[model samples]
Target: MPKAKKSQAKPKTKKAPQKLRQQVAALPVRLSEGGQIEVLLVTSRDSRRWIIPKGWPMKGKKRHEAAAIEAEEEAGVLGTIQDKALGHYRYSKQQADGREIGCRVAVYALNVTEELADWAEKGQRQMQWVRSEIAADLVQEPELSLLLRKIGPP
Candidate 1:
């Protein structure tokens, strides 16, 4: 009987981990007449999901500043933006080509003082002001929901 031939198999190679893209977002907020925290949410252009205003970093602007700019453009709100980040959340963004990219967003709290009647994204998106607790329920991101919950009155 001929000796059995040894099997030769190719070594398995691990795929490289996808890099997480960095972004800045603003959590627009205001105090209701009853002194309750109200969060301003904007509908995403493509999916129409409720999400905070976010985008890539802008030139000659700090992280928080860029976040504020995004808020103005996407949500049509303006106010004092905090320098420090409230927290960060990770999400997968779907691209036009059907690829999902990993992203990490640094959230800054923006106390909205003014809302524009006609803004860049006014017609493109719907804006809503809801109680913090309700806003938490309205959003899709878990970490962002937790952040919204933290801003509610004790």
Candidate 2:
């Protein structure tokens, strides 16, 4: 009797896990006429979901400074930003190749002092200043919503 031929199969290789990318965000805010705290939110470029101004770390810039710059460019707002981060939130960003990468964003409080009528990304997004409670309800990120709910008098 002839011996049975051995099966031939290639071994599966595991793909390397992607590292979590670091990002910074500015929680722009101001006081309403009734002395209630309000937050400034901008519509995301792709999904149009409400979000705070955020971006990747800028070269040679501190984390808080980068957050402030993102607020100006994305939301057309500028203000005094706290150097320390208020909190952090995790989210997944879709890349051009359709792969999702995990991102961790450090949020800093920005006391909005100036809002420009014309600025970068002006027409690309819609912005609103809502009471913190309402702002919490508007955002889709649960962690961000919790941060909004925790905001109190400055």
Candidate 3:
């Protein structure tokens, strides 16, 4: 029998969470007619988890501006995004190869000015405008939950 050749697969290396990848999230909010704090959340593309609009860094744009871009693409929100970040949260993001990467998200408040009748991701995901307290409860990430709960009406 001929000897089998060695496999060419590369060894897997684990990335350190301490050097967590940076991400930006848009916390789209608006005051309801009742003067209550209502936050906009969109379902994740694959997992369908309740999450704020977030994405990787954008070229040339500032962090918060990139976050605003994510909000527009994911939730159909047009608004004023605060220059300062409200807070940060860490979560494990599932990768294509069944690995979870650590992501540190800077949350920026977006005071919604207009919600489009139709936006980029209108049909792929479900968007909801719920009370801030309710948003805190719906998210699975504990740190995100705390962040949302602590965020006052803006």
**Top of the candidates by lDDT:** 3
The CA root-mean-square deviation of candidate 2, after full C-alpha superposition on the true structure, stands at 2.9
Please, what are the lDDT tens digits per residue for candidate 1 over residues 1-154? 9999989898899999999999999999899899888888989999999999999989999999999999999988999999999999989999999999999999999999999887787889888899999989999999988888887432
TM-scores, all models, native as reference? 0.91, 0.88, 0.88
Full candidate order by lDDT, most accurate first? 3, 2, 1
Q: Is candidate 1 or candidate 3 better by lDDT?
A: 3
**Colliding residue pairs in candidate 3:** none
lDDT of 3 by residue, 34-127 (tens): 9999999999999999999999989999999999999999999899999999999999999989988889999999999988888888899988
Candidate 3 wrongly placed segments (more than 4 Å): 1-18
Alpha-carbon local distance difference test for all models: 0.91, 0.93, 0.93
C-alpha lDDT of residue 139 in model 2: 94
True-structure lDDT of candidate 2: 0.93
Candidate 3: lDDT over CA atoms? Answer: 0.93
Tell me how many clashing residue pairs each candidate has. Answer: 0, 0, 0
